[model samples]
Target: MTTLVRGRGWARTHPLAVDAVLASAVLVCMVVGSFAEPNGEHGPTWGTRTPDAPSLVLMTLGALALVFRRRAPWSVLAATCAASIVELLTGQPRAPVVMCAVIALFTVAARTDRSTTWRIGLVTMTGLTGVAMLSGGPLPWYAQENLGIFAWTGMAAAAGDAVRSRRAFVDAIRERAERAERTREEEARRRVAEERLRIARDLHDVVAHHIALVNVQAGVAAHVMDKRPDQAKEALSHVRDASRSALNELRATVGLLRQTGDPEAPTEPAPGLHRLDELVDTFRNAGLPVEVALGQVGLDLAAAVDLAAFRIIQEALTNVQKHAGPAAKAEVSVVRVGPNVEVTVIDDGPGDDKGDEQRDVEQHTGGGHGLIGMRERVTALGGSCSAGPRYGGGFRVHAILPVTTAKGGTA
Candidate 1:
C-alpha cells in the first residue's frame, strides 16, 4: 500500500511521464493483439499472423498520438481515429490500431463536458464503423470488427464520464468539510473573547468599588490621627471592613475560574440586588449620604439581570463617593414598569469638574471603567444605557433593563 501511494504521488507530480507510460502500455497491447486471429481455427488463435508493413505503421502512429492525449485530447483523438480508418480501408490484413483510439476517446470524454463527449464519441464510433464496413474486404459489411469498434468506443466514453463525475463529487465533499472546520474554529474564538471580556469586567467592578472606599477611609484616618484618636480608630475600622469586603468579593470573582476539585472554593452565590442595603451602608460609612429607592420589589429577576442591577448601583455610588466632592449626595432608584426595569443614579455634586463629561469608552483618568462597564453590561442584556452631565449640574446615569432579556428569559 505504501509503495502504491508513493507511485501515485510520483504520477501526479509527473503527469506527462504517466501519459507516456500509458501510451507504451497501449502500444504493447495493440502489438500483442495483432498477432492473434479471433476467427481462425479454434475460437481464437495467438501467434498465427503477423501485421503487414502499412498496418504496423498505422498502429505505431495511433499509439504515438496518445502520448499527447492529456495535453490535446481532441487533437489526439482525431489523429488516432484517422489512423484506424486508414488501417481499416487500405491494409490487406488489419491490425488493432483502434485500441489507441479507444484510450484517446476515454481521455477526451474525461476532460471535456458531457455534451461534447457524447457528440465527439458518436462521431468517432459511427465514423470508424462506417469506414470499416465500406472497405469491401472478403468479410461482409457487418463484421465482428465493425461491431467491436462501436462497442469499445461507446464503453470508453461511458467509463470516462463515470470517472469524471466521481472526482467532482469527492472534491465538492472535501471543500465542504474544510469550510465547516473553519467555521467551527471561528465560533470557538468568538466565544473565548466574550468570556475573557466578562471576567475582566467582573474583576474591574469588584476591585474598583471597594478600593475606592478603602482609599477614602485610609485618608480620613491619616488626617485625624494626631488630634482625634477615637475618630482615627473608627476610620481605621472602616478601612479594615472595606479591605475584608474587597477580599471576599475578589475571592468570589476569582473562584469562578477554579476547577471543580480545587480546594477552598467559595460555595456562596454571586451578589445581586438583594444586597442593595449593604451596598448603601458601606458608602454611608464612608461619609457619602446615598439614598436608595427600590420600586422593583417582588420582581423575580433573572440571575444575570439582578447581578447587573447590583453592580450598576454599586459602581455609580462608588463614583459619587470618589469623584464627587466630600459633601455630595447620591440618589439610586430602580423602578420596573411595562416589561422594563429602569435604574437611575443621580448625584447633586459636580462630577469630576473638567473631566470626561460625555462618558464614552474612557470614563476617567484613574484607570477606572466607570460608565464603560455599566454600558457593556446593560447592552449585553439587550438594554439601553445612558450617562451624561445633567442639564443644570452633576452627573446622571440611567439604564432601562428589559424584564425579558435577549436570551428569551425574564430578569
Candidate 2:
C-alpha cells in the first residue's frame, strides 16, 4: 500500500510521463491481441497470425495520441478515433486499435462535464461500431467484435464519470475540513485575547486599591514617627496588613495563567460583594473614614454581577482616597432594587478639577485609569456606571448592575 501511494504521488507530479507509460502499456495489449485468432480448436489461438503493416501503423498512431490525452482530451480522442476507423476500413482483420480510443474517451469523460462526456461518448461509440459493421468483413454486422466496441465505450464513460464524482466528493470534504479548522483556530485566538484583558482588569483593581492604601498609611507612619510613636506603630501595622492582602490577591489572579503541570494554586473563589464589609474595613484602616449603608444583602447575586459590584465599590473608594483630599469623608451604599443592584460611592472631599478633566478625557478615549476600569467592568455586565464631580463638592461614582448576568451563576 505504501509503495502504491508513493507511485501515485510520483505519477501526479509527472503527469505527461505517467501518460507516456500508460500509452506504452495499451500499445503492448493491442499488439498482443492482434496476433490471436478469435476462433480456434479449444479457445482463441495466439501467434496464429500477426497484424499487417497498416494495422500496426494505425495502432502505433492511436497509442501515441493517448500520450497527450490529459493535455488535449478532445484532440487525442479525435486522433485515436480517426486511426481506429481507418484501420477498421482498410485492414483485413481489425487490430483492436479501438482500445486506445476507449482509453481516450475515458480520459475525456473524467476531465470534462457529464453532458459533453455523453455527447462525445455516443458519437465515438456509434461512429466506431457503425464503421466496423459497415466495413465488408467476413463476420456479420452483429458480431461480438463489432458489439464489443459499443460495450467497452459505454462502460468507459460510466466508469470515468464515477471516478470524477468520487474525486469531487473527496475535494469538497477536504475544503470543508480546512475551513472548520481555521474557524476553530480563530475562536481560540479570540478567547485568549478576552482572557488576557480580564486578567489585566483584575490585576489593576487589586494593585490600585491596596497600593493606594499602603501609600497613605506609610506616609502617616512617617509623619509622626518621633512625636507619636503609638499612632505611627498602628499606621505601620495597617501598612503590613495591606501588603499581605495585596500579595494573596495577586497570587490568586496570577495563578489563573498557570499550566496544568504546575503546582496546585489556592482554590478559593474570587472576591465579590460577600467581601464588602472586609473591603470597607481596609479603607477605614487607611485613615479614610467611610460610612456604609446596605439596603439588602446582594450575596445571592450572579457571580459576574457580584464581582463587578465588588470591584466597582473597591475602585470608587480607592479613587476617593487617592484623588479626594485628606480629611474627606466617603459614603458607600449598596441597595438591591428590583432585578438589579445599585452601588454608589460619594465623597465630600474637594477633588482637583484639572485632574478630573484629564480623567474625563482618558475615560472617553478608553484609558486604563481606575474610572475607565470601573466603567468597563460595568459595561461588560450590560450595566451603566458614571463617575464625576457632585453638584457642590467632591466626586461620586455610581453603577447599577444586573442581579442576574447573561451567564449567571452564584458565587
Candidate 3:
C-alpha cells in the first residue's frame, strides 16, 4: 500500500512521463487488436476481420492524441472522436479506436466543472454510439458491441467527476489549515509585544525613582565632606544603600527575559503595599518629610493591585522630590472603600504657574515618564489614575484599583 501511494505521488510530480506511458500502452492495444480476426473461432473478437492501411493509420492517430489530454482535454477528445468516426464511415473492421476517445472524455470531466462534464459527456457518448449503430458494418445495430460503448462512456464520466470532487475537498481543507496556522503565529507575536512593553515600564519606574535619591544623597555627601565628617559619612552610606536597591530591582526586572532552562533567577517577591513603611523611610532619608495616613474597610487586595498601588505612591513621591522646592512636605494616604483600594499622594509644595509649566515641559519632553507608567499600570488592571496640580498650591496623584483578583476570586 505504501509503495502504491509513493508511485502515485511520483506520477503526479512527473505528469509528462505518465502521459507518455499511457499513450504507449494505448498504442500497443490498438496495434494488437487490429491483427486479430473477428470470428467465433478466435478466443475473442471486436467485430473486425482484417486490418486495412487507412484504419490502422486512423487508430494510431487516435491513440497518439492521448499524450496531450491533460493540457487540452477538449481538443484531444475532439481529435480522437473525429478519427474514430472516419474509421466507422469507411466501413473498416472495428478496432480499439474508440478507447482513446473514452480516455480523453474522462480527462475533460476530471479537470472541468460538472456542467461542462455533463454537456461534453453527453455529446461524446451520443455521437460515438449513434455512429456505430447507424453506419453499415458487419455487425447489426442491436449488437452487444454498440451497447458496450454507451455503458463504458457513461461510467468514465461518472468516475472522472468523482475524482474532481475529491480533489476540491482536499484543497479546501489544506487552505483552511494554512489560514489557522497564520492566525496562531500572529497571536503569539502580539502577546510577546505586550509583555515586552510591561517590562519596559517596570524598568523605567525602578531606575527613575532610585537614581533620583542617589543623586540627592551624593550631593549631600560631597557638600559636607570637610566641615562635617560624620554627617558626610551618613549621606555616603545612604547613597550606597540607594545604589544597591536600584541594582537589585533592575536585576529582577531583567530576569523576566531569561530562558527557562538557564540558571534559576531571583525569587524575591515584588514590593507591594506591605512595604509602604520601608518606601517612606527611604524618601524621608532623602530629606522629604512625608506623613502616611491609612484608613481600612477590610478588603483583601490582589497581588497586582497591591503592586500597582505601591508603585504609584513611589512614583508620586519621587516626582515631588524632583520638582517641588526643598521645604515641601508630602502626604501619602491609602483607603479601602467597598471592593476598591484608592491611593492618593499630595505634596504641599508651592506649585506656582512657573513650576507647573516647567514640570509639564519636562514630562512632555522625555525628562519624566513616571506618571505615564503609573497610569498604564493602573489602567491595565481595570482602574483609573489622575495626576495634576491641585487647585490651591500643591500637586496630587490619585489611583483607584480593584481589590478582587482577575479570576473572580476575592484576594
Candidate 4:
C-alpha cells in the first residue's frame, strides 16, 4: 500500500509525462465516480451533480489542470481551489477535486522555499476549510466531514515539505564530502612536489663538488705530463679517486628519481661538518692553500641540518677552486653559537684570475643551482645562508643553520 502511494507521489513530483498520466488517471476516476451510485443513499447521488452539462464541463476543466500541476503548481492550486468553491456554491455534490489541490500543494512545497510553502499552505487550508463550512445546505459547520477536509489537506502539505527538507540536507552532505576529497588530493600533490625538490637539491650538491675536483685534478695531470711524470701520475690517481667517489654518490642520489624497479636509497651518513678537514686536505693536495678553524663543537645537530652544513662548505670550496686564482688562500671556519652553527668560507683570490676557457664551468655557476640548493636546504631545516664578496678582498660564503629541526629535534 505504501509503495503504491509512493509511486503515485513520485509521478506527481516529476515532469510532464508522469504528471500527465497521473492527471489522466485522476480524471478517469472522477468521471467514473460521477456516473456511479454513492454507497450511502443518505447524500445526493453522483448522477445528480452530472445532470447539468455546464457543471460537468467545469469539473472536467478543473481536473485537466492537474496535467500541468508539477510545472505550474500555483496556477493549478488556484484553479482547483476556485473549481471546488464553485461546486459548493452551485449546490452540487463536492467533486473529486481536492486530490488535484493536494498534489499541487505538494509540488509547491517540495520545489519552493520553506517560508513560501508555509504561507501558501496556510492560505490554501483556510480557504478550502472556510468554503466547505460556510457554503452548506445539509452539512453543519462542526461536522466531522468538514474537519476531515482540513486535516487531510494539512497532512499533504506538511509531508511534502518534510521530504523536500531531507533531500536538501542529503545534497549538502554530499557536496561537503566532495570538497574534502579534493582538498586531500591537493595536499598529497604538494607533499610530492616538496619531496622532488629535496631530491634535486641533494643531487646538485653531489654532482658539483665531485665534478669540480675531477676537473682540477685532470688539469694538473695534463700540465705536468712531460715535466714530471711522477707528479702527473699522482694527479691522475686523484682524478680517478674523485671520479669513483662521484659515481658512488651519484648512484645514491639518482636512485630517488626512479619511483619503481629501483633498489632502496642509501640511508647511510654522507660527509658533514665532521668531514670538513678531509675536504680541505683534498683541496690542499690539489695545490690550493687552505686554513681551517674549528670552534669548540660538542653539539649533535639534525641529520638534514648537518648535511646542509656539509653541502654549504663543499660548494664554497668548489667555487673558490673554480673562480679564485691558484695562489688564493682560503679560510674555512665552523663556529658553534647557542642553538645555531655558523660556517664561513672566505678566499683571498683575484676574481679575474681563473680561466674563462671552460664554458661548461661558467654555465654551472650561471645556473645558480649551487646557491639555490644551499638556501633551500637551510630554510627547510629552519635556518639561513648568505654568499657574497668581502669588503677588502675576495668572495665569502656564510651560512647560519639551526641545530634543531622545526619539531625541536636535533637536526
RMSD of 1: 2.9
Residue 174, model 3: lDDT of 96
Candidate 2 lDDT over residue span 19-90, tens digit each: 999999999999999999886778789889989999999999999999999999989998998998898899
User: TM-score winner among the candidates?
Assistant: 1
**C-alpha displacement of 151 in model 2, angstroms?**
1.8
Candidates in order have lDDT scores of: 0.85, 0.88, 0.84, 0.77
What local lDDT score does residue 252 receive in model 3, on the 0 to 100 scale? 90
lDDT (10s digit) by residue, model 3, range 17-88:
899899989988877877765445555655446678887788779878898998888899999999988877
Candidate 3, residue 166: how far the Cα is off, in Å: 3.1
Instruction: Count clashes in each candidate, considering only residues at least 3 apart in sequence or on different chains.
Output: 2, 0, 0, 4
TM-score of each: 0.89, 0.88, 0.82, 0.81
Q: Which pairs of residues collide in candidate 2?
A: none
**Candidate 1 TM-score to native:** 0.89
Instruction: List all candidate RMSDs to the true structure.
Output: 2.9, 2.8, 3.8, 5.0
Q: Candidate 3's C-alpha lDDT? A: 0.84
Per-residue CA lDDT of model 4 for 197-316, tens digit only, reads 987877777788888888998999999999999999999999888888788888877765767766788765676778888888888878888999888655476777777788888888
Cα error, candidate 3, residue 334 (Å):
3.8
* Local lDDT at 242 for model 1: 89
- Model 4 spans with C-alpha error above 4 angstroms: 1-14, 28-70, 87-91, 257-264, 296-299, 353-367
Tens digits of per-residue lDDT, candidate 1, 42-157, equal: 67798889988888888888888888998999899989988988888887667899898899999999987899889988998899888988984988887788889889999999
Worst 10 residues of 2 by lDDT: 359-368
Worst 10 residues of 1 by lDDT: 357-366
